[model samples]
Target: PHYYSLLAAYLECQKVGAPPEVSARLAAMTQELEARQRTALGGLGAATEPELDQFMEAYHEMLVKFREELTRPLQEAMEFMRRVSRSSARSPSRADRCAISFPLA
Candidate 1:
């Protein structure tokens, strides 16, 4: 779910013309998070109760770091899109300014 969410946001960032470096970094981070999840899940079957508890603790910590790493780029992309939308709204295109004829009701 997290991966998909991030992927969607990354794609949106690209669509909204966020910086290439920012999008690339985000894509890399998303892939890294997915890899970590896969690795963690793969080791679960071999863990004893105590080890499982330790793994959970470490996994939680990793998630916290992952969230921190992912948040910055997403925020930057959102801010960029906000600015873009604001500017676009402020400056209408020539077509946008043209009057549309409507039939009288």
Candidate 2:
């Protein structure tokens, strides 16, 4: 799930014309994270219940860290894109102008 989100963010970076190195670095990090997850899951066989609980707790911590690390670059890229868009003279597309319609309570 996080891997897919990273890929989507990388694609968005490309769509917004972020630097080549930025996208490349993000792709590399995503691959590394996925590899780590695969390795961790593969090592879980034959563990006792208490050990499994500890492993899960540690895995959860790792996921939180991974999410924080992955989001920072994407957030920076998005903010940069927003700044550029705001400064440009070109009008936004119709899709950009459209607002979400919420159902009344």
Candidate 3:
């Protein structure tokens, strides 16, 4: 949701086509988002836990799924743009190497 919101706001700003004032507002919004993320992640030392190792092992699969589904497409598009004035495309789509591992002692 956050990614999509950011993309929409970005594309909207782009479609407005960079009048100087609009560009300044977009830059401000970008900074605002950075500040929000930083504030959200500011607490760590006093956090509580219930077997973090086990929770993390469970969520590792979730992280991989989210990264593949959400982040991978954006990464691919960025790579393609970096090639030949956006004339090139992604090399190939590879199957994800999904794995299963038993959590243990």
RMSD (CA, Å), each prediction: 11.7, 15.3, 21.3
Per-residue lDDT of candidate 2, residues 12-45 (tens digit): 4443344678867766776777777677667765
40 in model 2: Cα distance from truth in Å?
Answer: 24
Q: Write the per-residue lDDT of candidate 1 for residues 1-105, one digit (tens) a residue.
A: 244344444444443344778767767776777787678666655435776566666655565566567667878988999999999888987587896989999
TM-score of each: 0.36, 0.39, 0.30
Candidate 3 TM-score versus the reference: 0.30
Best by lDDT: 1
Q: Candidate 3's residue-wise lDDT over 68-96, tens digit each?
A: 56555666777776874544334332343
- Ranking, lDDT, top scorer first: 1, 2, 3
Question: Any idea what lDDT model 3 has?
Answer: 0.55
Of the pair 1 and 2, which is ahead by TM-score?
A: 2
Candidate 1: residue 102 Cα off by (Å): 33
State the weakest 10-residue window (summed lDDT) of model 1: 1-10
* Cα-lDDT of candidate 2: 0.63
Candidate with better lDDT, 1 vs 2: 1
